[model samples]
Target: MNSVKKIAMLMCIGLPAFVHAGEAMVKWHDFNDYRDVRATNQAKGSYHKQIASSIEKHAIKLAEQLPKGYKLNLEITDVDLAGDVSYRGANEIRVVKPIHFPQLTLNYSLMNETGKEIGKGNDIKLKDMSFMDKIKMGRDESFYYEKRLLTEWFGEEILPKIN
Candidate 1:
């Protein structure tokens, strides 16, 4: 009876370790864009494009940094723009035109080769602040901020939990 109990305990402990021994790979799928900014606005379009591109680049970097022999995959499920607004000023005439900043929400899923979800992260907010400040200063700053956010999220929240 004791031997059977010991065997059950060992199986429970060793099963997951064995399952995790296989190599892991990560890939990114399509991402949703929920921002309401008009495509005609060149500046807004450029900004949005940069954000999307940066996210993809960072995803690849994070995947490469994952521990060896563990397979993982990331799929972008949705991107939700929470809100956006513009400010305009005039002295009986249009001087400084309205500038807009968009708030974004991203949802993603992390899974393994078995089609089982290992972990999922959602509603990660990426806020656009170009409307509040000069483009020269805001553009580079926002890009760096977004990059850092992605790194932290993947390293702290996702990587550790991955087998």
Candidate 2:
């Protein structure tokens, strides 16, 4: 029937619009590291940048998983990354089993495209004690630890809570 064909065409165009109605986007990633410069590592700024990149990546994934028309605004401060090298004597430091925990104070919220607050104060210290998993570290293994924490947090906590 002519009416049935019109209904089918209308459904094809209308369904996707409804399905994507609550989707979100990564509006910004604002990282502020307030660690004392005296206790900072050589790669402090660069390392934090890498962490921000990981957050942006995962936030986008999270946005896709959530409903449509929302945006994520995240501000991370007081970043303390894992591991510390101990000074021995000369311009060198001991690298044996340098273990430390990474922590970041995160302040984040979600807003609709029309500027409605969907969530807030989700202010949390981003840290995962179980990320290491008793794995032996080679040289420069610190790079992956923070990312693992972010990924697991997004998957287990944020993803389910928002969607």
Candidate 3:
């Protein structure tokens, strides 16, 4: 009876791990800017962390939108915000008005419970191409542009298939 008790205890401890092994969720790893020019300032560094956090939260919510055993793996390759700011002088910077277009590149894939690949997308770019034509970006607050871009992408790309 001692051997039986030990076996049962082992199973109880290990069963949950086995079950969660195939659990589905967002697997975002080592997300960082791949562009050659990188920001060195403290503000930009902080902003990048914030951006990553937002993406992680959104990805989790996106995962919950799908059925069980469906995992979405995403890698953010690049991030270019709406506007370009150039230093005009010693203490001033000139903002490029017409070129403030938000863009993001991601390599993503969807996998089922058994690790079967349902779909995949590489070099997927999410960009607001109609920025100059109709909608004018009026706000200059933090994360306004990037949050909008991610929200739109989640709504259009991920929500449809899940629903």
Task: Please give, for residues 1-163, the per-residue lDDT of candidate 3 as tens digits.
Answer: 6999999999999775554332224344343534421233346567567667766775675566566677878877777766665555553332535556778788877777777877778888887866556553666645555566766776787656544
The clash numbers for all candidates, in the given order, read 3, 6, 1
Candidate 1 local lDDT, 73-155, one digit each (tens): 44443343322333344212112222434343556666555657777666566554553353333345434544554566666
**Candidate 2, position 54, lDDT:** 60
Write out the backbone clash pairs for model 1. 24-70, 24-71, 25-71
Estimate every model's Cα lDDT from 0 to 1: 0.51, 0.57, 0.63
As a TM-score, model 1 comes out at 0.45
- Candidate numbers, best lDDT first, in rank order: 3, 2, 1
Winner by lDDT between candidate 2 and candidate 1: 2
lDDT of 2 at 34: 50
Once model 1 is optimally superposed onto the true structure by TM-score, how far is the C-alpha of residue 158 displaced, in angstroms? 0.6
TM-score of each: 0.45, 0.56, 0.60
Model 1 residue 30 lDDT score: 36
Model 2 C-alpha RMSD to native: 7.2
lDDT string for model 2 (45-156, tens) is 6755655566567556555655566666666655655554566665434242334665656676767667787677556777755545656455553446655565566566
Report the CA-based lDDT of candidate 2 relative to the real structure: 0.57
